[model samples]
Target: MSLFVDSSSIRNFLRRDWERAESQLGSVLSDTMVKLGAVLNELANILDGDSAAKYLPLVGDLRKVKRFINAILLMQIEKTNLGRTDFDKRDLINLMLLHLNYPGLFRRIRNLFAVEPA
Candidate 1:
């Protein structure tokens, strides 16, 4: 047997891969949203539910973080909805994944709380 593949065969192979990856990404996004929601809920419970609102800027920051992640998820979810990957879709996904990276987000927020008001 010859070890050569035609262009169409390669295209089909890549297309199937893209579709599978998209399905997996959709599951990942859904699971991430669920876990994030649970964490936020747990924080609220620890803060005493309705009283969590009394925390002012901390509570505000929590809300902002939820919105931020939702936005990122929606962007990253675009390729999954299309069920395919292309140059454009991959660009958005890559950037969103970077945004989801650790410590930068945590450190930035931690610094805000670390300030000692004069």
Candidate 2:
């Protein structure tokens, strides 16, 4: 339900339908990134020497999420070499990304394909 709203907002943005989709994703990724920063900062303060080593994966995951969000935004507006008719998935970090740009019946079909795990 909520994901459909998100995808529609993003599509509106890419199609230059800005007035209504202005807030689009509503800073969801930005908010997540900020929390990641806070976690990293806290880890830095409490971790040191040998104990700090184990927290590396957590930090890495945070960074990956931050990058993933940025990548999605960037790719949303990009056109493939085939022209403005299609979007390329080779560079998209999330499979859900490609689904958003498709139109009409395809878009609905894509929604089903990109469904999140239950």
Candidate with top TM-score is: 1
Q: Scored by CA lDDT, what does every candidate get?
A: 0.43, 0.38
Give candidate 2 regions above 4 Å deviation: 1-60, 75-87, 94-118
Residue pairs clashing in model 2 are none
TM-score of each: 0.26, 0.20
Best by the lDDT measure: 1
* TM value for model 1: 0.26
Task: Please give the lDDT score for candidate 1.
Answer: 0.43
Instruction: Give the Å shift of residue 102 in candidate 1.
Output: 15
Give the alpha carbon lDDT tens digit for every residue of 34-55 in model 2.
Answer: 4333333333342343643443
Candidate 2 Cα RMSD after full superposition onto the native fold (Å): 18.4
lDDT per residue for candidate 1 within 1-118, as digits (tens), equals: 4324443332343334333544676755555444334333433343454554443233234334344346555644433433253545334433443455444875676677896878
